[model samples]
Target: MMNSPVETIFYIIDETATILQEELSCTYLEAVAETGENLFQDDILQDEVSEVTKKRLQKSYEEANIGEQPNETIRKAFQFAILKGMKENVQPNHQMTPDSLGLFISFLVNKFITTEKQLTVLDPAIGTGNLLTTVLNQMANSNVHSIGVEIDEVLIKLAYVGANLQKHQLELFNQDSLEPLFIDPVDLVLSDLPIGYYPNDVRAQDYELQAKEGHSFAHHLFIEQSIKHTKGGGYLFFIVPNGLFESTQSQQLHEYLHKEVHIQGMLQLPTSLFKNEKAGKSILILQKKKEGIKPPKEILLATLPSLMKQSAVEDILAKIDGWIKQNK
Candidate 1:
């Protein structure tokens, strides 16, 4: 029932009965990275997702014009794969956790942007466009606009269709977020930044030895780099695991980030949030500001809920919304 990127972006998911994929792609450990496989082979996106699910999914992608995004490498392959899985009655969670999306939306709707009356957002790291899709659903055509950037060309194309389906005016770029990037000033910025894991190569030679300890130096560095363009006072959010978040051993890396940005809040997620083989996960929310007093150290943390559990997504969303409204 969704029509355009603006209309369909977040139209498909029902917070009550969201399913999850068992394993996220092991791109970091795999000898090779197959963006296509990860994009299409997701368990939840399979045939078991339901006709209503497929319809919502297709509507979201179509509205965004994500399929027609500026790259031929991406096609309807991801969509086809999801439906194919559904046809077989597969009900696994895939690359992302729809259950956690409500928490994120609560953050986006209230804390992240200056106002919900109007918004043009950006997600630099759009994997299969899940987070952005979730954000779109939360915004619900309330004059909230969006743009997403993804390194994987294939996913960008799939995201284009999903994003366009929501009636969002999206511009997908086939480029790494680390490189000099450009986009119009936006009110909100959300991303699952590229931690050193996941088949990253930017710091291979620079940090191969220290790879086991934490994210590469390049990733830590990129955090500061991306913040440069994020408008002052604009909200910024991303995930970093326990190894990185509470790393007394790796204090230098995150400490530098703490120094560079004014952290607004943080969500110390449980390890289960990352169904992938990765060590752990954490969610951070900060603001891009030119001048300001440091954010409180008592950074209120939202505990990471089970990403793959039989729970009500809206219940979680309501909890988050209550927090957001209170914060304002």
Candidate 2:
């Protein structure tokens, strides 16, 4: 919330970022390529939020008398403040992940995470890095390595700050995920695929070559990319618009999954669960087929009403967990 008469802008950024990271951990580094008018220029906002930066940040926190509030309360206040300030004072361009949806997806995937020494998770369009951070929070474990690829500079900066503040080891990149990219394939691929269409001309010539023309949604391209970058036998949890299941554009994707991947489950999310958007969403869980293994013939699919509670979501996941165990 930079709009408030904050004597120090760094303070708001620092405090609000605490929610993204755990307390007193040094597992990340924050990088912002440039500064905006609302955040001051390079003269004030520089490469890192180090001890010197905190001194400036602390002054504003003291002025606001935020020393007495618990970290959670402060985090909530700071999140709203930044969100409001960004909307009212600064230009709006990015979408933030809702806390409930972030946590819900994380909760659904928790059981699948393991103590494997080389676990790696990737989020191709990691806006603000909330979903990945939420996954780490739910696990409350530090053994996993996380990575995110984002195109927006500002969102990646915020994500880097949050990952560092939480003391979680994260690798962040600012690049177009739709283009030809190189990263070692990972074990788990998680994403809230950004909505919209990619330009037919700019899209890589051979991207998902099987998809026909006039079927050029960005989300479809991203899903294809995620599948390519996922290890055999690894898993993917994508929160995509429900339209993917019905759209003719996604016919190629459906065919590919039917032949090469096992549809673990699909959990329909509440409509309007995401702020500022009207598309119905669902979490599609899939596992890449290892060599010599055939895809499962049956899939587990369920829907939750818009009015369902957190506990109810948990119950539904528990049922899905049981099914996974039986089928595995």
Candidate 3:
């Protein structure tokens, strides 16, 4: 219940003990200690650690009231990093970042959504349940069945455990995301993707585009498939680097998106929220609109607040709620 980041981080270590063993393969004492040390060692992790604690203070987040907090976030990062550390197949460079995990949670809560009655949510790379757990937390304890396609069995197990801890009814499969998503009509929660320079099985059925992280590969295609499952006005949220906003190569995708999908909102998130030491990281919030309705002439553009701090998260939720209410 303490406000201090160190204390809050430790608090989550305590809160998730049972599930870590049962689901994510982390024993409380061992994993927590290991992760804290690794976080300190990694220069990228070190750079953001101070802002982490300061941001908690800035947000005035209630350690006790919030069902889950950033501490869980830090732990998930450790778990993912360590798991990657042990595996040669998955690169250590691109574990799902903690702050983006938090932002994913923010986007879900801000929407209060379940935007479509029939469509389900999916995460192809669901490394250790960062996105799924966040989605579970926002469901108001309701069972929203979601599917996670992860090549790592360990992460699939982690997602299973994390979902269970929150009592979220979910299905997790160890599969590659690039292959066709058989679970059609599913909206996606895309987090940190494998960038080109990073290590990943290039031969994996779903992998392509070596220049950028696997983040840009077939994402729009996935969006198109999601439309089959997504009802009109259903929302799709993806975390893409800043380059996507200004890239010349992406003009085709952007044009395709505007030509077909209705624009809901585009948010440029802060850089510190990233897991890796990279130049650009952002959250893209998109809404699936009905076919034939003219898309909004002016896309709603928001410069997202720093996700490291709690106040930033709450402020984002408040504004999004205001937007939905105004439109509704």
Best by lDDT: 2
Instruction: List the global CA lDDT of all models.
Output: 0.52, 0.66, 0.52
Candidate 1 vs candidate 2: the TM-score winner is 2
Per-candidate Cα RMSD to the true structure, in Å, reads 11.0, 7.6, 11.1
Best by TM-score: 2
Local distance difference test, candidate 2: 0.66
Give TM per candidate.
0.59, 0.75, 0.61
Runs in model 3 lying further than 4 Å from the true structure: 1-90, 99-119, 187-192, 197-232, 275-278, 292-294, 307-319, 326-328
Q: Write down the worst ten-residue block by lDDT for model 3.
A: 37-46
For residues 1-328, what per-residue lDDT tens digits would candidate 1 score against the true structure?
Answer: 5354322312222111122231332222110112222223322244444666555545443434443442211223233343433444433312443445434554544544544577777777775575666666556536776777777654565566555544456778788665666777776777666655434554433432234454445446445555665676677776665556554436665555565566666666655555564656666777665676345545545665665554744565566566655654
Weakest 10 consecutive residues of candidate 1 by summed lDDT: 25-34
Q: Name the candidate, 1 or 2, with the larger lDDT value.
A: 2
Query: Across residues 134-229, which tens digit of lDDT does each residue of candidate 3 receive?
Result: 555545534356777777665565555555544456777677555566665654444445434223335333322322444344444444444445
Question: Candidate 3: lDDT over CA atoms?
Answer: 0.52
Ranking by TM-score: 2, 3, 1
